[model samples]
Target: MTANFSGDNSSTDLLIEHRREIADLLQRIKNRRLQVFGLYATPIALIVTLLAWAGSKIFIWLHGDTPTAVNSVFAAAVFILGVASVIQGLAEFGSGSPWEDSETSVRGLKLDLSLAEEKHVLEARRHTPPVSDRQASYKERIPGEIARLRKESRHYRRLHLLMQWLLFISSAAITAVTAWYDPPQPAKGALIGLGATVTIIAAAAGYFKPRERAFNLQQTADSIEQHTTALELGISPYSAAGEEENLKTYAATVEGLRAEQRMREQQLDQPQQGQQQVI
Candidate 1:
């Protein structure tokens, strides 16, 4: 009876350990999803508010001094939107809450760690007495799990693209309406120039959306690979002789790539900041 109790206690301990690991892994996944949602949603909201402001301003300027209560209300609404956008952008920029892409990488690491732990547990279970086969099917579905994650990532990318295009369309429409209402003349050259600048910015954003998505996807994938390799090396005790070395090499390569990307982003952002300052 003592031996039976000891065996049951060991089994219970293993079950508790597994459950704890699973719970941690699930929490990381939830956090990652939230981070991605915030990344896309926050930017889109700001862009829409900016476009509304720009559109209303252009309309008011085109139809000067004919101000009715409706126009005043519309202008107030646009001003409110602009103020809200500034607040939201400041919050996002200051807190860096929504742009927490690193959290996704952390979650990927947790998943990889969970997987390695699972492998260790399975090996231990195999060496011990027979257990039920219920968990085997779930383990076998890892490919499906990966596929689902990839699909979700792609969906987020598509949503980001859609938002970019919508911003571009709205900006373009505003510019077009402004030009139609008051064509380019020497007297209103400044207004025409402002409209042209807005249109150009919108066009550039639309053009760059695909490139940005590609870059972000590559970065995210590289992060996942690095995290996975690190977790595998850290957790798996019985890996092949060179597996640890390989993982280290993989991680180093990914880190180098990420550093290069950061440098490039900094270079790009500097000029944009300078331009904004000048403006």
Candidate 2:
């Protein structure tokens, strides 16, 4: 049976607007973070480029071959441009991301939404008579939570696979490039640095262990699905003569699975270098 959760039109509209605003704000925050990261990375990129350029220049000097007028002018211009860019990036990066205001707003809106939702629920209960305890659960909670778990699992799975491929490809490229250029050229050094960047990223990914998160989430999702299907099919746990008892069992099992998944995620988030235990 479907659950009727709506209150009055106005309250329903307010809830909808609140959700829309929250989504928009979250998107804005994500975009802002990306922008800030780009700004912060710019100076590091400039330094790497300058280091490569200086190395190339040093190699030329060691050969006792002076640069042509045009080559010297070009190198000078490039160095000056790189330096200016580095300064600009450093200045902007020091200001850091302005996340405080937006995050504060998000928190305020969430609190308001919680209070409004509680009031809305009370209004709904007052207007519509008492409902079956399972009405909301059977109709909304199970499906929503299952969908969320599936989506989170997929997201983490994809991230883990992508990072795994990066680790593999970067290691291969580093070896291949080193063999390809026996000479110590700046270009080769820059390529090696790029490969090291991938290694660093892979190390960070390892620490986070998206694979474990995906495993735990998928396991929880599968568990929930299995119990749901058994409950619907009136199998062992649900075979009892009492419908309420079956529903209670299903609720308890699903909650337990969810709690376990949350704990697994927290353990994965710890700041350790060791392999995470996938529960």
Candidate 3:
């Protein structure tokens, strides 16, 4: 009897340790995700500032001596406007609480599991609803959340595209005004037009291309929520055990999706960098 009791205690300790390990892993993944999101605004901010400064210089060169003070004020206003746009973009990109959103889903699953475990321990609990009912509730909430996230993503994408096009149009208009007044030497005019055309094309492509990793991360989170609910309700018996398995699956899927997204983002960055290099 003594040996049997000792064996039981040891098994219980091992289970506790495993649970702690899983929790740690999940926390690490979440931290990494938050860090990645926080850094996303930096590059856009730099680009906006650089473009504004370049545009201002071009305007000055084109206008020459006429209304010098007015031109300077206009150039300063354009720079300020560019800075404001960058600030606005950063706020929009980061304001959605993506990390919080993901964490909320994870917390919901954890709560359900904790309640289920507590009921199992109590044994005398008679009013507890069946797992199936709990699962159904989860499923009902998930689709709405997924739909909301998809809508928001689409809206932001469109907004970003609009901003890119607006920047290109503004740049072209400035260039045209400058050329009309200053009339760049034939060779210079040709080069300027070529450069502006290339920049616009590059920006358009970057804005429209699918952000593979971000899309993947979002889908993975949704899938994890769905699977967690299914597993808890015994509607779908996954290969792995408990909430930990669901979390692991979700993290793995997110990592894979993020990798692809990062690759695409890098590709987008390259063309912009190349353009800057030429300038």
Candidate 4:
């Protein structure tokens, strides 16, 4: 019964099939990157918080009182634990795209195809899902696209702020601690964790570049809105006599912008892409 419903794919069908897979793989790669970052970042954040709590307690205990043998013991313990945690984080999460190599290899597998390999793969890929016939009109979808892009823009903007502020606060804390006074041994050991925190945070920032994402998303949304407005007003290129043609123009422009936005995001997610200046 299953075989009866399935049709063998020709070269053309295989081309379409591979193209769709590539697009889906690209999206999955981005998702994988985010998941890996969160996986490492969450624990690192907890470690940082714990270090701050420990440091605060140490400071409060030492503020006016003369440093005692007991205080040194406690500080040493905190220093050992905090520094270990931070080093672990830097080792694991210090930021080029994690898990990206596997995905890239998968993509390479897809690209390095042969006629024989394609045939073998096609034998298993014959089961194609039915494409949906019902679709939302541009009128129904454009507003939603505009809204989504704007919302994502805001989300990335907030992320940018959070990462930036964390880096700033970490840097200032490190500097202030160094300049304030000569620290006794235990406190100095604990402060090393703060420095490591800054390294991890900077690595995350450079890799993610959330500011670039926010800007690109907002730019795409704005361009889409501009096209939408022009289309509705029937002005210039959209001034075609037929409303259908005007709508077509708007759809093309909006989709092109959306595609560009997705490309920009892919660039942001790739560490090597960071070397190139973002558009």
Residue-level lDDT of model 2, residues 1-279, one tens digit each, is 123444445555765665676566566556556555655565566677667657766876666664687467657766766776665555445466344332233455456556666665665555543344544356357877888998999998999988888888777777777778776474577676868879787887878788888889888888898888898899977799887778877777778888888877777776664224343
lDDT of 1 by residue, 1-279 (tens): 999779867876776677676776676677666655655665576577567656766876666654477567656666765675565555445656544434346557566667957865884675454322332332244335435545655865776676567666656666666667665454366555555766765666654454454555456555555455454555442244664454454445545655665554454445566636644
Off by over 4 Å in 4: 1-136, 273-279
* Model 3, span 1-279: residue lDDT tens: 999678656656655655665565566457645544544555555566566656766776556553667557656766765675565445445566444333234455456557645644453243234455444445456556556656655765665566567667757766775667665565476657656775776656566544443464356446656665665564544556665555445445534544654554566456667746644
- Candidate 4, after superposition: displacement of residue 233 in Å? 1.4
The number of residue pairs in model 4 that clash at the backbone is 0
| Top candidate (lDDT) | 2
Would you give me the overall lDDT of model 2? 0.69
Give the whole-model CA lDDT for all candidates, comma-separated: 0.57, 0.69, 0.56, 0.68
* Colliding pairs, model 2: none
Candidate 2: segments with Cα more than 4 A from true spot? 1-118, 124-131, 273-279
TM-score of each: 0.32, 0.55, 0.28, 0.49
Q: What is the TM-score of candidate 3?
A: 0.28
Worst 10 residues of 2 by lDDT: 97-106
Candidate 1 Cα errors over 4 Å, as ranges? 59-61, 65-107, 113-117, 120-124, 127-279
Model 1: lDDT of residue 259: 68
How do the residues 174-255 of candidate 4 rate in per-residue lDDT, one tens digit apiece?
7777777476354586468878988998888787887888899899889888887887687887888876666666667777
Q: Sorted by TM-score, highest first, which candidate order results? A: 2, 4, 1, 3
Q: What is candidate 3's CA lDDT for residue 127?
A: 29
